[model samples]
Target: MKVIIIEDERPAYEKLVHFLKRYSDQTEVIGAAQSVQEAVDVLQQKGQQADLLLMDIQLADGLSFAALDQVPLKKPVIFITAYNQYALEAFRANGIDYLLKPLTYDAFSSSIDKLKQLSGTFSDPLQSIQDIYKKLSKPQYKERFLVKIGDHIHSVPTEQIQLFFAEGRNTYLVNGAGRRMITDYKLETIEEMISPEQFFRVNRSYIMSLTGIKDVLVYSNSRLKINPSFDFKEEIIVSREKVAPFKEWFGGGI
Candidate 1:
């Protein structure tokens, strides 16, 4: 089997290589990339020679999905990531298996075995992957959050939320009623739990809801400033890198 590895961490890459060798002496690693840009370049140049791709979701530059958006890969992929939240996205991108890191030999072997079995059984590899994806259940996003207020508990529906923001080390949720409540979940966790159609992470500090947005003004440095329905002390500005995606999300393209 000829494979390509896309991983940023050195130890993880070395461990993966060791496991591949243990799986079969005939298994050959044809290419390796450490970042999204490198992965794109490598895939464009040597992708045809690779029979399989072993990729990490997070890379040095950005997420591996960014590379997939730029390059069209036909080979089956096995995704390795520390976070389980990316499993749905992984499966959508020609993935046969999604393995969480701190990878075990048994897990690695099983994924390889499954790949071989499926390859031998199905003549159309892409169709097989699509069938497997259809069999897997879809991700269920959070519908409501339970917040404690002194002696009382409040169940806040996700649709009522205007935004989620991080202040210092703590995260807070703002509802449509202009009430602020502390949440245990970090902004990163909140980003994964909410429906993408309704919310977007504008910057590192803020995730804004579509219905809550009052105005979008062109800001300095090619960024965008967001005015929400509720009062917020700090300005909500979309990061320069995220500007394009934010626009797409706002336009319902994402």
Candidate 2:
């Protein structure tokens, strides 16, 4: 996947590059632009050379939405924004997923998967952007879950889960009451089932609830550490690259 990142902030761009290298090795970042006009020029010049676009809503020149009006971008786009207000505009303008500032690997990877799915169905690429949006917009996510415990099967509700964590190869669920139980599904499998508005995947091993985050502490490495309400032995640290989006999600970005 050849991607073009359009972000004005130096740190945010660097952070995304870092995570992309670690998680998404298959994706090659072909180019980057710091402003709206630059992005327009780059996209117009590259045309079909670029397979995907990671665009920022606010650019040095102006809104990215306005910039796209000046040129035709056929590649699938995944929007990046510091605020939630621009999300609606992104969707209308061929966006696959709106990643709030401080993009996490989980969210980024999920968006990539969505883009792949969209590409598989549509032949004209962005021509079916609106169609892809309408198809994926209303998905039937998992509402309730069934958990099995030694000889006794227990049912768990999505609202009660504080977070889902994977250890070694097994996935576990930490409920509202701080009880840990083994789950049959993996983190990747459950990630698709839950609503993004309520749960944010801060790292590879954990997908946490907005309500369960007790405190957000700045780590020594400049990343943010999530202090969950539950008694989790594993440290939950949101990488420096993902801290911004995590904060936005925590603040109710949706």
Candidate 3:
């Protein structure tokens, strides 16, 4: 199979390549692109040479779906993303399968198998994916979180959350009022639950809300330091690699 990968994250791209190589020795990676514009260019120029596309939903420039809009892609796409909210949109844009981030080899293999099986069985494979998508319900983000304090439960709206952080092994959330509470969900799961427009995982340790940001300052090593509205014991620094995407997200560019 001739494949093209469109992913902004270097680690993810490398991992996907590793998985592809493990899946089949015959699978040839024809090309790779990162941004939406680059993806559009690659598809327009090399779309005929490729049989399949392994695409990431979110890119540094914009959503990968925009590339599909600019170029009429006839190739089958398997969208891989951290966020589940775009599943319906992925299916609408000729996506045969949707795989979530931290992708397992089993899931990747199954999606490839499904793509091959569908293509061999049906004349219009993408139509079958769309039909299945229509029957599914749209993904929903968490609106409210229930926290327990001394056998008493309180419901806190998602908008009231200032930030989420991990301490040792436990995850905690701080409200707008600076009240900290423990949550059972991991930072990764919380990342998927929240809207990207409102929340950004500045680092592996912290996920900050836009409304919670008080100031942004340049830190050492080309990184950024975030000052949240609430008090935090540890210094919250954005990783160097995430600086560009953090700036874009902070500026409302994406």
Ordered from best to worst lDDT, the candidate numbers read: 3, 1, 2
Candidate 1 matches the true fold with a TM-score of: 0.50
lDDT of 1 by residue, 10-74 (tens): 99999999999999999999999999999999999888888889999998789998988899877
The parts of candidate 2 lying over 4 Å away from their true place are 120-254
Clashing pairs in 3: none
lDDT of 3 by residue, 1-254 (tens): 99999999999999999999999999999989999999999998898898889999999999999999999877788899987778778877878888877789998998888878877334775676675465344555799988888898898899999999999998989998888998889999999999898999999999999999999999998999998877766788999988999999999987
Summarize candidate 2's per-residue lDDT along 1-254 as a digit string, tens digits.
77788889998888778867776678788888898878878877774687888788988879988767887665678788777666567766777777765577887777777777766344554554554455446655688888888899998988999999988978989998888888999999999899999899998888999888889888987788989987777799997777888888888887
lDDT per prediction? 0.87, 0.80, 0.88
Candidate 1 Cα outliers beyond 4 Å, as residue runs: 120-254
What is the Cα-based lDDT of residue 133 in candidate 1?
61
For candidate 1, the lDDT comes to 0.87
Off by over 4 Å in 3: 120-254
